[model samples]
Target chain A: MMLLKSESLPIVSEQDIVRARQVARQWAIDLNFKLIDQTKFVTAVSELARNTLIYGRGGFMLLEAVEKDLRKGLRAVFEDRGPGIPDIEEALKDGFSTGNSLGLGLPGAKRLSNEFEIISQPGEGTRVTIARWT
Target chain B: MERIPILRMGDFLLVTIQVDMHDRLAMTLQDDLTRQIVASNSRGVLIDISSLEMIDSFIGRMLSNISLMSNVLAAQTVVVGMQPAVAITLVELGMSMPGVRTALNVEKGMMLLRECLDSDDSEVEDDAS
Candidate 1:
């Protein structure tokens, strides 16, 4: 997808996740996506945003409006400088939790987007990128 | 702190989550519902998420907590008004939200709560035997 515009929000607090969902929903609507699609984006942002705040030990999210093959969509990249995941595959398991949660982290967000990717280092941090096309 | 309003409807407490629920708000709802259920001695709770566009893992767990808590308090909880899209997203997200009773709308949700209350009564009858 070709980038239209991008903005970043800090994910250090729970309030940030709320703001991320709001911004993602507005972006999805601006792209003329349907309600369900917008909801999907908002929900995915909530999940990843939480991961960034809790697991990442504080990070930021980059929101991008993009166009792909003449279709508009939204992309979000969450980056955090915390203890990175030791095992990406196990983290994606449906009921897996490294902490106290449902553990529907990476997998759930991946399902909501048209494109999803994650990059992480053992002690550095983690970055997850996801995009949805209408 | 913005509180999501909870309305009392006879033996049922009605909570319409009309905000973009964050973690704190979801937790607050869980606490408030627990207190109201006990204080009012209500038999059922109907949580309306029609206006809610999203339910993350934290909020999803809060919903389940409310159900389990109300059950222990001798009250049944019914979640309703989940948008078609939200349901699809939850399923795709792999939450499935086991043990959380749901219905299409508020009216139907009340009906489900009543059914549970009826079953509770039947159980009491069996205990009397």
Candidate 2:
């Protein structure tokens, strides 16, 4: 397994969210992921990117392409310096929402990827890294 | 704020989404659809999402909200032409859009709406202004 070439982009605005999704999709396509897998990854990127902007108040995302035993995957890291989640457990709940949303963002993104991780501090910030295998 | 256009045909309203759905755009669409439904007295609303390949939980909530609002205003909402991948992603997202209706395409959606309106004529008549 190896971490291949990667690209980073700021997630301060709505357009950045779209940019992340597009870049992730292109990478997934280049890696020869299935159409459904591409869509899954793109959707996950969209959700997490939005969370970074709205909840995290702005962040950065890294699109990293990786390989394990010759199998390829795309990894995205969304990091923000905004107010972090106090309760990771509650935030992952399907119907829980703090911002007038469906509360599906975190969990849904988790479902759409093969690997998901989150690190946050109440006063510091939050960072979520997700990876999807091709 | 980008606006998604709403077209009226007889007693039905048609909306074809062709752009990236940012949060602001989704909110705007929800508000616009409500206003259009009220103004046109539309009995059915059709949303074509075949062109939209990606979506998130926020958009999912907005779709559900639109369905709920249309119901309150005496109109039926049908979301049609969802891409297969989008369908799989939505199901995995766990936001099944509980109260919203769906169809494979615009033609089938209109048929479904017509059937619903015909079968529930009395309810439509009683509630619709």
Candidate 3:
């Protein structure tokens, strides 16, 4: 696996979430990803970015383009220093939102990506990474 | 500062969401639509989302909210022109968007709204008679 390109954008406000989605869409398109793939990736980014802003109490998103064995991929990592999830298992469950949302962010993002990962520590922060390969 | 515009079309209120709405913008649209439905005394609401590339859970919930609120205000809400990819993504996101009626396009949505509104009005007329 090799990183070809990378960029970081702040996720402190609602507008940042929209920017995150647009950046993800552009990255997917640049990788020649199909329309469906682009939409799915962008939607996943929207969910995770919102989570980073609302749950993570504002953070940043890292976008990376990677090449692995001639296969290209796009990866996004959301990092936040807000109060971390106390129960990762429960939080991942659909309809289990601590906030008033529909509680689909974590699980939905996982479904939309080819690869998904989460790391969180109470009172510390949380980080979520997702990738889709072509 | 940008807000989604709502247009009056006969007994219906039409909103074409042409922007990639941020969270606050989506919420503001919801609020604005709800108020407009009452002020216009609209019998139906048609929302065109064909320009939207994606509908995350937040936006999906907002759409559902708009549908429900419109119903409570004695209006029928029809969301139309959802991209196939967005539809697939919404379902995969675990949001079926229950309680929200959808149409294939603006034309179909308008027809459905008119059909439902007509039936509703006739039902009220029968009660009055």
Top lDDT hit: 3
| Each prediction's fraction of true contacts recovered | 0.89, 0.93, 0.93
Task: Evaluate model 3: give its TM-score.
Answer: 0.98
Error of 1 at A8 (Å): 1.2
RMSD of each: 1.4, 2.2, 0.9
TM-score of each: 0.95, 0.95, 0.98
True contacts kept of 1: 0.89
Docking class of 2: high
Question: In candidate 2, which residue ranges exceed 4 Å CA deviation?
Answer: B122-129
Report the lDDT of model 1 for residue B26: 85
lDDT of 2 by residue, A64-90 (tens): 999998899999999999899999999
What lDDT tens digits, residue by residue, belong to model 1 across residues B1-129?
789888998999999888887788788889988999999999999999998888877888899899999989989889999888888888888888788999999999998888888888999999999
Candidate 1 CAPRI classification by DockQ: high
Q: For residues B25-51, could you state the per-residue lDDT of candidate 2 as single tens digits? A: 899999999999999899999999989
What is the Cα root-mean-square deviation between model 2 and the actual structure? 2.2
DockQ of each: 0.83, 0.82, 0.92
List model 1 lDDT by residue over A12-131, tens digit each.
898898999999988888889998888788888899999999999999999999887888889999999999988998888888898888899789998988899999998999999998
Model 3 chain B scores worst on lDDT over the 10 consecutive residues at B113-122
lDDT of 2 at A109: 93
